[model samples]
Target: MMAYYARRKLPTSCLCRVSELRRQFTSASPLFFQGTSSVLSNRVPSSAPEGTRLTGCNVFKNKDEPLALADEEYPDWLWEILDPEAQQKKLDADPERKAKREWRARMRRKIKTDNFLKTMS
Candidate 1:
Protein backbone atom coordinates (compact mmCIF):
# COMPACT_ATOMS: atom_id res chain seq x y z
CA MET A 1 0.00 0.00 0.00
CA MET A 2 2.88 2.39 0.87
CA ALA A 3 4.70 1.54 -2.43
CA TYR A 4 1.42 2.13 -4.43
CA TYR A 5 0.93 5.53 -2.72
CA ALA A 6 4.64 6.41 -3.30
CA ARG A 7 4.37 5.47 -7.02
CA ARG A 8 1.26 7.78 -7.34
CA LYS A 9 3.31 10.61 -5.59
CA LEU A 10 0.37 11.48 -3.29
CA PRO A 11 1.21 13.98 -0.52
CA THR A 12 -0.42 12.14 2.49
CA SER A 13 1.29 14.38 5.10
CA CYS A 14 0.26 17.61 3.23
CA LEU A 15 -3.42 16.44 3.25
CA CYS A 16 -3.36 16.16 7.10
CA ARG A 17 -1.69 19.64 7.38
CA VAL A 18 -4.30 21.13 4.97
CA SER A 19 -7.17 19.62 7.05
CA GLU A 20 -5.65 21.02 10.31
CA LEU A 21 -5.30 24.51 8.72
CA ARG A 22 -8.93 24.35 7.47
CA ARG A 23 -10.14 23.36 11.01
CA GLN A 24 -8.18 26.21 12.63
CA PHE A 25 -9.44 28.80 10.06
CA THR A 26 -13.08 27.63 10.42
CA SER A 27 -12.90 27.79 14.27
CA ALA A 28 -11.31 31.33 14.27
CA SER A 29 -13.46 32.87 11.46
CA PRO A 30 -16.22 35.42 12.42
CA LEU A 31 -17.95 35.29 8.99
CA PHE A 32 -21.30 34.10 10.46
CA PHE A 33 -23.47 36.56 12.49
CA GLN A 34 -25.15 35.12 15.64
CA GLY A 35 -26.79 38.07 17.50
CA THR A 36 -30.14 39.85 16.80
CA SER A 37 -28.24 43.00 15.61
CA SER A 38 -27.54 41.28 12.23
CA VAL A 39 -29.31 42.37 8.95
CA LEU A 40 -31.17 38.99 8.65
CA SER A 41 -32.78 39.56 12.13
CA ASN A 42 -34.95 42.44 10.71
CA ARG A 43 -37.17 40.14 8.54
CA VAL A 44 -40.86 41.12 7.96
CA PRO A 45 -43.74 38.60 8.33
CA SER A 46 -45.44 37.62 4.98
CA SER A 47 -49.17 38.39 4.54
CA ALA A 48 -51.54 37.28 1.72
CA PRO A 49 -54.08 39.71 0.17
CA GLU A 50 -57.88 39.30 0.63
CA GLY A 51 -59.67 36.48 -1.42
CA THR A 52 -56.25 35.04 -2.61
CA ARG A 53 -54.79 31.69 -1.39
CA LEU A 54 -51.25 30.85 -0.22
CA THR A 55 -50.52 27.59 -2.13
CA GLY A 56 -46.89 27.21 -1.03
CA CYS A 57 -44.31 28.71 1.36
CA ASN A 58 -43.83 32.49 0.66
CA VAL A 59 -46.01 32.07 -2.53
CA PHE A 60 -49.17 34.13 -3.22
CA LYS A 61 -51.45 33.82 -6.29
CA ASN A 62 -54.77 35.34 -7.49
CA LYS A 63 -58.15 33.81 -6.35
CA ASP A 64 -59.11 33.01 -10.00
CA GLU A 65 -60.05 29.30 -10.48
CA PRO A 66 -58.68 27.18 -13.38
CA LEU A 67 -61.07 26.72 -16.38
CA ALA A 68 -61.95 23.09 -17.28
CA LEU A 69 -61.11 22.01 -20.87
CA ALA A 70 -63.69 20.00 -22.89
CA ASP A 71 -63.21 16.17 -23.04
CA GLU A 72 -63.95 16.24 -26.83
CA GLU A 73 -60.79 18.34 -27.37
CA TYR A 74 -58.53 15.47 -26.15
CA PRO A 75 -57.67 12.47 -28.41
CA ASP A 76 -59.60 9.13 -27.93
CA TRP A 77 -56.28 7.20 -27.56
CA LEU A 78 -55.21 9.53 -24.74
CA TRP A 79 -58.45 8.86 -22.81
CA GLU A 80 -58.05 5.04 -23.39
CA ILE A 81 -54.48 5.23 -22.00
CA LEU A 82 -55.60 7.30 -18.96
CA ASP A 83 -58.69 5.14 -18.03
CA PRO A 84 -57.91 2.19 -15.63
CA GLU A 85 -60.70 -0.05 -17.12
CA ALA A 86 -59.40 0.53 -20.68
CA GLN A 87 -55.80 -0.23 -19.56
CA GLN A 88 -56.96 -3.50 -17.87
CA LYS A 89 -58.91 -4.48 -21.03
CA LYS A 90 -55.82 -3.82 -23.18
CA LEU A 91 -53.65 -6.00 -20.89
CA ASP A 92 -56.29 -8.80 -20.83
CA ALA A 93 -56.38 -8.72 -24.68
CA ASP A 94 -52.60 -9.43 -24.88
CA PRO A 95 -51.86 -13.17 -25.79
CA GLU A 96 -48.52 -13.28 -23.92
CA ARG A 97 -50.12 -11.83 -20.72
CA LYS A 98 -52.99 -14.33 -20.95
CA ALA A 99 -50.48 -17.26 -21.26
CA LYS A 100 -48.49 -16.03 -18.24
CA ARG A 101 -51.69 -15.66 -16.15
CA GLU A 102 -52.82 -19.21 -17.08
CA TRP A 103 -49.34 -20.61 -16.22
CA ARG A 104 -49.34 -18.86 -12.82
CA ALA A 105 -52.81 -20.25 -11.99
CA ARG A 106 -51.70 -23.82 -12.91
CA MET A 107 -48.52 -23.53 -10.78
CA ARG A 108 -50.55 -22.23 -7.78
CA ARG A 109 -53.02 -25.19 -8.11
CA LYS A 110 -50.11 -27.68 -8.37
CA ILE A 111 -48.45 -26.19 -5.27
CA LYS A 112 -51.69 -26.47 -3.26
CA THR A 113 -52.16 -30.15 -4.38
CA ASP A 114 -48.53 -31.02 -3.44
CA ASN A 115 -48.96 -29.39 0.00
CA PHE A 116 -52.20 -31.29 0.58
CA LEU A 117 -50.54 -34.64 -0.39
CA LYS A 118 -47.57 -33.97 1.88
CA THR A 119 -49.86 -33.16 4.85
CA MET A 120 -51.90 -36.37 4.22
CA SER A 121 -48.70 -38.56 4.04
Candidate 2:
Protein backbone atom coordinates (compact mmCIF):
# COMPACT_ATOMS: atom_id res chain seq x y z
CA MET A 1 0.00 0.00 0.00
CA MET A 2 2.88 2.40 0.88
CA ALA A 3 4.73 1.51 -2.34
CA TYR A 4 1.52 2.05 -4.43
CA TYR A 5 0.98 5.54 -2.94
CA ALA A 6 4.72 6.42 -3.27
CA ARG A 7 4.72 5.50 -7.05
CA ARG A 8 1.53 7.60 -7.75
CA LYS A 9 2.05 11.08 -9.30
CA LEU A 10 0.47 13.93 -7.33
CA PRO A 11 -1.57 16.54 -9.25
CA THR A 12 0.22 19.97 -9.35
CA SER A 13 -1.69 23.28 -9.08
CA CYS A 14 -0.81 26.92 -9.96
CA LEU A 15 0.29 27.42 -6.35
CA CYS A 16 2.82 24.56 -6.70
CA ARG A 17 4.22 26.12 -9.92
CA VAL A 18 4.58 29.59 -8.28
CA SER A 19 6.23 28.04 -5.18
CA GLU A 20 8.70 26.07 -7.37
CA LEU A 21 9.58 29.26 -9.34
CA ARG A 22 10.06 31.19 -6.08
CA ARG A 23 12.32 28.43 -4.73
CA GLN A 24 14.44 28.40 -7.92
CA PHE A 25 14.82 32.26 -7.91
CA THR A 26 15.70 32.39 -4.21
CA SER A 27 18.22 29.52 -4.49
CA ALA A 28 19.98 31.23 -7.46
CA SER A 29 20.20 34.67 -5.72
CA PRO A 30 23.42 35.27 -3.67
CA LEU A 31 21.56 37.96 -1.53
CA PHE A 32 19.02 35.34 -0.31
CA PHE A 33 21.82 33.14 1.21
CA GLN A 34 24.15 35.91 2.53
CA GLY A 35 25.99 35.43 5.88
CA THR A 36 24.92 36.99 9.22
CA SER A 37 27.82 39.53 8.97
CA SER A 38 25.47 41.76 6.89
CA VAL A 39 22.75 41.51 9.57
CA LEU A 40 25.27 42.37 12.37
CA SER A 41 26.37 45.47 10.40
CA ASN A 42 22.69 46.65 10.11
CA ARG A 43 22.06 46.56 13.88
CA VAL A 44 21.61 49.76 15.92
CA PRO A 45 24.57 50.78 18.14
CA SER A 46 24.59 49.10 21.62
CA SER A 47 25.15 52.46 23.37
CA ALA A 48 22.29 54.76 22.32
CA PRO A 49 22.48 58.35 23.65
CA GLU A 50 20.37 59.18 26.74
CA GLY A 51 16.76 60.60 26.54
CA THR A 52 16.18 58.98 23.10
CA ARG A 53 14.63 55.56 23.76
CA LEU A 54 12.68 53.20 21.47
CA THR A 55 9.10 52.91 22.80
CA GLY A 56 6.58 50.34 21.50
CA CYS A 57 3.78 52.92 21.69
CA ASN A 58 3.59 56.69 20.97
CA VAL A 59 2.99 57.45 24.69
CA PHE A 60 6.64 57.54 25.87
CA LYS A 61 5.98 57.69 29.64
CA ASN A 62 8.26 55.68 31.95
CA LYS A 63 6.90 52.51 33.69
CA ASP A 64 7.09 54.33 37.08
CA GLU A 65 4.88 57.18 35.78
CA PRO A 66 1.19 57.12 36.74
CA LEU A 67 -1.21 56.09 33.91
CA ALA A 68 -4.14 58.27 35.13
CA LEU A 69 -5.04 61.49 33.34
CA ALA A 70 -6.26 64.61 35.22
CA ASP A 71 -9.57 63.97 37.06
CA GLU A 72 -11.19 66.90 35.25
CA GLU A 73 -10.22 65.45 31.83
CA TYR A 74 -11.32 61.85 32.56
CA PRO A 75 -14.82 60.67 33.63
CA ASP A 76 -15.45 59.48 37.22
CA TRP A 77 -16.48 56.02 35.88
CA LEU A 78 -13.12 55.70 34.04
CA TRP A 79 -11.23 56.13 37.33
CA GLU A 80 -13.60 53.72 39.07
CA ILE A 81 -12.97 51.13 36.31
CA LEU A 82 -9.14 51.57 36.48
CA ASP A 83 -8.96 51.26 40.34
CA PRO A 84 -9.18 47.61 41.55
CA GLU A 85 -9.38 48.69 45.25
CA ALA A 86 -12.39 50.91 44.48
CA GLN A 87 -14.07 48.08 42.54
CA GLN A 88 -13.43 45.66 45.46
CA LYS A 89 -14.80 48.23 47.95
CA LYS A 90 -17.92 48.64 45.78
CA LEU A 91 -18.36 44.84 45.62
CA ASP A 92 -17.94 44.56 49.42
CA ALA A 93 -20.53 47.32 49.92
CA ASP A 94 -23.14 45.43 47.82
CA PRO A 95 -25.12 42.97 50.03
CA GLU A 96 -26.03 40.64 47.13
CA ARG A 97 -22.40 40.42 45.88
CA LYS A 98 -21.12 39.85 49.45
CA ALA A 99 -23.57 36.92 49.86
CA LYS A 100 -22.56 35.49 46.47
CA ARG A 101 -18.85 35.71 47.38
CA GLU A 102 -19.52 33.89 50.71
CA TRP A 103 -21.62 31.24 48.89
CA ARG A 104 -18.80 30.63 46.34
CA ALA A 105 -16.21 30.34 49.13
CA ARG A 106 -18.47 27.85 50.99
CA MET A 107 -18.98 25.78 47.80
CA ARG A 108 -15.19 25.70 47.14
CA ARG A 109 -14.52 24.53 50.74
CA LYS A 110 -17.28 21.88 50.49
CA ILE A 111 -15.86 20.60 47.15
CA LYS A 112 -12.29 20.43 48.60
CA THR A 113 -13.59 18.54 51.69
CA ASP A 114 -15.55 16.07 49.53
CA ASN A 115 -12.46 15.39 47.31
CA PHE A 116 -10.30 14.85 50.43
CA LEU A 117 -12.87 12.40 51.84
CA LYS A 118 -13.02 10.50 48.52
CA THR A 119 -9.21 10.14 48.42
CA MET A 120 -9.16 8.92 52.08
CA SER A 121 -11.86 6.27 51.37
Candidate 3:
Protein backbone atom coordinates (compact mmCIF):
# COMPACT_ATOMS: atom_id res chain seq x y z
CA MET A 1 0.00 0.00 0.00
CA MET A 2 2.89 2.35 0.81
CA ALA A 3 4.55 1.49 -2.52
CA TYR A 4 1.33 2.21 -4.42
CA TYR A 5 1.31 5.88 -3.42
CA ALA A 6 5.03 6.31 -2.96
CA ARG A 7 5.47 6.59 -6.72
CA ARG A 8 3.42 9.78 -6.73
CA LYS A 9 3.82 10.81 -3.05
CA LEU A 10 0.15 11.73 -2.72
CA PRO A 11 -1.00 13.15 0.65
CA THR A 12 -2.58 11.01 3.37
CA SER A 13 -6.06 12.45 2.74
CA CYS A 14 -5.83 11.44 -0.92
CA LEU A 15 -4.56 8.02 0.10
CA CYS A 16 -7.51 7.52 2.47
CA ARG A 17 -9.90 8.56 -0.31
CA VAL A 18 -8.28 6.11 -2.72
CA SER A 19 -8.59 3.30 -0.16
CA GLU A 20 -12.27 4.18 0.28
CA LEU A 21 -12.75 4.12 -3.48
CA ARG A 22 -11.13 0.68 -3.62
CA ARG A 23 -13.59 -0.57 -1.03
CA GLN A 24 -16.48 0.97 -2.98
CA PHE A 25 -15.46 -0.86 -6.20
CA THR A 26 -14.49 -4.12 -4.56
CA SER A 27 -17.50 -5.91 -6.05
CA ALA A 28 -16.39 -5.21 -9.64
CA SER A 29 -12.69 -4.52 -9.10
CA PRO A 30 -10.35 -4.43 -12.08
CA LEU A 31 -6.73 -3.31 -12.37
CA PHE A 32 -6.54 0.49 -11.96
CA PHE A 33 -4.38 1.00 -15.07
CA GLN A 34 -6.09 -1.52 -17.39
CA GLY A 35 -9.53 0.17 -17.09
CA THR A 36 -12.47 -1.09 -19.24
CA SER A 37 -10.26 -2.85 -21.83
CA SER A 38 -11.82 -6.25 -21.11
CA VAL A 39 -15.29 -4.72 -21.22
CA LEU A 40 -14.60 -3.16 -24.62
CA SER A 41 -13.40 -6.46 -26.07
CA ASN A 42 -16.64 -8.27 -25.10
CA ARG A 43 -19.05 -5.56 -26.34
CA VAL A 44 -21.41 -6.55 -29.21
CA PRO A 45 -23.68 -3.98 -30.82
CA SER A 46 -27.25 -5.24 -31.20
CA SER A 47 -27.59 -4.39 -34.89
CA ALA A 48 -25.71 -2.73 -37.72
CA PRO A 49 -26.70 0.76 -38.88
CA GLU A 50 -28.58 1.22 -42.17
CA GLY A 51 -25.89 3.30 -43.86
CA THR A 52 -22.18 2.58 -44.26
CA ARG A 53 -20.12 3.08 -41.10
CA LEU A 54 -16.84 4.95 -41.30
CA THR A 55 -13.60 3.19 -40.40
CA GLY A 56 -10.69 4.46 -38.27
CA CYS A 57 -12.78 7.25 -36.79
CA ASN A 58 -12.51 8.09 -33.06
CA VAL A 59 -16.16 9.11 -32.67
CA PHE A 60 -18.30 7.34 -30.08
CA LYS A 61 -20.38 4.50 -31.59
CA ASN A 62 -23.39 5.01 -29.37
CA LYS A 63 -25.51 7.71 -30.97
CA ASP A 64 -27.90 7.50 -28.02
CA GLU A 65 -25.11 8.72 -25.68
CA PRO A 66 -23.62 12.20 -25.70
CA LEU A 67 -20.08 12.83 -27.03
CA ALA A 68 -18.65 14.31 -23.84
CA LEU A 69 -19.24 13.83 -20.11
CA ALA A 70 -18.02 17.34 -19.21
CA ASP A 71 -19.95 20.59 -19.81
CA GLU A 72 -22.91 19.10 -17.88
CA GLU A 73 -23.43 16.30 -20.45
CA TYR A 74 -22.76 13.50 -17.95
CA PRO A 75 -25.00 10.48 -17.44
CA ASP A 76 -26.67 9.62 -14.14
CA TRP A 77 -24.45 6.60 -13.47
CA LEU A 78 -21.33 8.75 -13.97
CA TRP A 79 -22.67 11.46 -11.69
CA GLU A 80 -23.20 8.89 -8.94
CA ILE A 81 -19.52 7.85 -8.88
CA LEU A 82 -17.99 11.26 -9.60
CA ASP A 83 -16.64 13.67 -6.94
CA PRO A 84 -18.61 16.83 -7.63
CA GLU A 85 -15.86 19.21 -6.47
CA ALA A 86 -13.21 17.46 -8.57
CA GLN A 87 -15.52 17.30 -11.59
CA GLN A 88 -16.30 21.00 -11.33
CA LYS A 89 -12.60 21.86 -11.08
CA LYS A 90 -11.70 19.67 -14.06
CA LEU A 91 -14.56 20.66 -16.33
CA ASP A 92 -14.45 24.41 -15.69
CA ALA A 93 -11.29 26.12 -14.38
CA ASP A 94 -12.66 29.69 -14.42
CA PRO A 95 -12.84 31.81 -11.25
CA GLU A 96 -16.58 31.15 -10.95
CA ARG A 97 -16.02 27.37 -11.17
CA LYS A 98 -13.16 27.55 -8.66
CA ALA A 99 -15.49 29.35 -6.20
CA LYS A 100 -18.21 26.76 -6.70
CA ARG A 101 -15.78 23.86 -6.22
CA GLU A 102 -14.38 25.40 -3.04
CA TRP A 103 -17.90 25.91 -1.68
CA ARG A 104 -18.83 22.31 -2.46
CA ALA A 105 -15.63 21.02 -0.81
CA ARG A 106 -16.34 23.07 2.29
CA MET A 107 -19.96 21.86 2.39
CA ARG A 108 -18.84 18.24 2.16
CA ARG A 109 -16.35 18.78 4.99
CA LYS A 110 -19.04 20.43 7.12
CA ILE A 111 -21.49 17.58 6.47
CA LYS A 112 -18.89 14.95 7.34
CA THR A 113 -17.84 16.78 10.53
CA ASP A 114 -21.50 17.25 11.53
CA ASN A 115 -22.14 13.56 11.05
CA PHE A 116 -19.06 12.73 13.15
CA LEU A 117 -20.33 15.05 15.93
CA LYS A 118 -23.71 13.34 15.79
CA THR A 119 -22.03 9.94 16.14
CA MET A 120 -19.97 11.18 19.13
CA SER A 121 -23.00 12.75 20.82
lDDT of 1 by residue, 1-121 (tens): 5576568665465345345544543343242223223213322111222444323222125534333334444344532332344456677889899789889999999999999999999
Better of 1 and 2 by TM-score: 2
lDDT of each: 0.47, 0.46, 0.46
Q: Tell me how many clashing residue pairs each candidate has.
A: 0, 0, 0
Which candidate should be chosen as best, given TM-score against the real structure?
Answer: 2
Candidate 2 local lDDT, 1-121, one digit each (tens): 4455336532233235345544553344344223334323332222213443333222333554223233244443432332344467778789899899989999999999999999999
Error of 1 at 56 (Å): 19
Ten-residue region with minimum lDDT total, candidate 2 = 39-48
| lDDT digits (tens) for residues 32-109 of candidate 3 | 223234323322221223343423222345544222223233243332243333345455758877788789999999
Count of backbone collisions within predicted model 3: 0
All candidates: CA RMSD in angstroms?
26.6, 24.8, 17.4
After superposition, the stretches of candidate 1 with alpha carbons farther than 4 Å from their true spots are 1-88
Clash pairs, candidate 1, are: none
